[model samples]
Target: MYLNLTPKQMVRLNLALAVLFSGVGVYGLQSDSLPISPYTCFTLAIACVVQAYYSTEKFVAKAALSNTITATDTSLTVKQVYYQCEKEEIVELSRISQLKVADNYLAVILDGNGQGYDFQIKGKAEAIIERLNEVLPKALLKNSPIKQV
Candidate 1:
């Protein structure tokens, strides 16, 4: 199951912020005396718009299951899609060598390969962290305690 981790008002707030930033950028570009760069404001506006897209929680595609495995296998491949903006890959928890949890982020390391995926936790971190705790291994959090939000 997919869960939305962003606050309900975040979408509106981000869009509003995008509008404000874009307007600022435009105004800044019009005047040569402004201390702030118009390009910087435009960049911030684009960033806000991207965050708004992420906060919207829209599903783009579902994961596909294939590549048959033997019956003796301990873990199987399953598709997990977070959001359209984030990566959607075939990652099994059993393959994870390390897990990092925090108020604003979650990181999973795979099989000591020095490669990992990091997810940014937004809005209500507690709820998302709790859900992750449910689906993920308890041992992953034994060392790292999630800070209260």
Candidate 2:
């Protein structure tokens, strides 16, 4: 089974804000009717640009990579953000000892190795849990309990 997770996205809104502020800045540069100085408008424009850039970067680096979870009979592959980049961890079905679901994140632990990978669930823990139950074996979750938030 494959699942595409929904993440809170605001790039459009941020870009829109940047454009609005940029228009105000350009107008301020061309006209002297407003009481505010042109420097203020320029500052606001620069600030907006920076905000848009960071928001876009964050969405791409963090949420974009964490966009899907794929499970097969052999393994479970999860897309997760690692450091400043995206990493895919493919754990064997038998290796996954536990699947922990939180309100906003899911953690998968590998047996013996104790290695863990966490992915953002974004308030869809229930859906993820359901999907896991369908693909994963019952024995793996015998010790794991679903916690309702």
Candidate 3:
């Protein structure tokens, strides 16, 4: 079974916030009456730029993941994008430990380890959960924790 997921709207919101913060920082630096010191304004501007860069990077990464998950009876392959580059991770089904469904995200645990990768669900979390239920191993899903939104 193949599953494709897209980035949620929060990505865009973060981008917008980044821009707003940057503008405020720049304006603060230019306005003498603003009461904020030049150093403070500069620091704020740098922070905002850093946030914007990360937000844009996150958006790109999520966009690149569109329809990149491919799962077979034996293994699952996930293609992830980072800074315009593509990376693939392949895992054997036998290595999967469990799946966790939270309010608006899903996590795939591997090798009976507590660590895992998380994906944010775009819409209707229940639908995604149901589809996953059909495609994933019954044992993995049986004792999984699903949080209510």
Candidate 4:
């Protein structure tokens, strides 16, 4: 099962890039014919290659869940692999007092002993939250039953 990014996203990205760098590529191509310093053309070509590499990586991640979660008896392991441009964080499911799926991210409420970090699953936030609810053991998810203290 693979989750794909919407076609509209791809189309919009392509259109934006076309508008952004088409002139640069065309200028480089035209200048290469003029027989001046070849460095400008080389630089432009390199820039295009780098841009393609970056976009390809982003598209791959946007197309699927780059991270994985494995539920265990005592705790849940959330191995979140973020894109190179993105940041990654480690989270222990035992510390999570609550889990909420918001519009675009997962809000993992942590316990006081930990730093109380909220783990955000980037693309498939809802799916990840559902999977966690399904696969996580009852003990890890059990709270104190709301005792009045």
Lowest summed-lDDT stretch of 10 residues in model 2?
A: 2-11
lDDT of 3 at 87: 65
Q: Estimate each model's TM-score.
A: 0.49, 0.53, 0.47, 0.47
Give lDDT tens digits, candidate 4, residues 1-149: 74375645545555555544555556656675554444554555556545454446454554344344555565655544344444445566666676655533555556744344444454455566566667776666576111111
Candidate 2's residue-wise lDDT over 53-145, tens digit each?
A: 545655445553235466777888777654455667788877776667865677877774657787764446777777677666566567654
- lDDT of model 2 at residue 143? 62
Model 1 C-alpha lDDT per residue in residues 26-80, reported as the tens digit of each score: 9988888888899999999999987776666342113111211111123322233
RMSD of 4: 8.5
Can you list the residue pairs that collide in candidate 3?
none
lDDT values of the candidates?
A: 0.57, 0.64, 0.59, 0.52
State, as a TM-score between 0 and 1, how close model 3 is to the true structure: 0.47
Mark the regions of model 1 whose C-alpha exceeds 4 Å error after superposition: 1-8, 59-73, 76-100, 103-133, 136-149
Cα error of candidate 3 at position 68, Å = 4.4
Over 4 Å off, model 3: 1-24, 35-68, 81-83, 103-105, 111-128, 137-149
Candidate closest to the true structure, highest TM-score: 2
* Runs off by more than 4 Å, candidate 4: 1-16, 24-63, 85-92, 112-115, 142-149
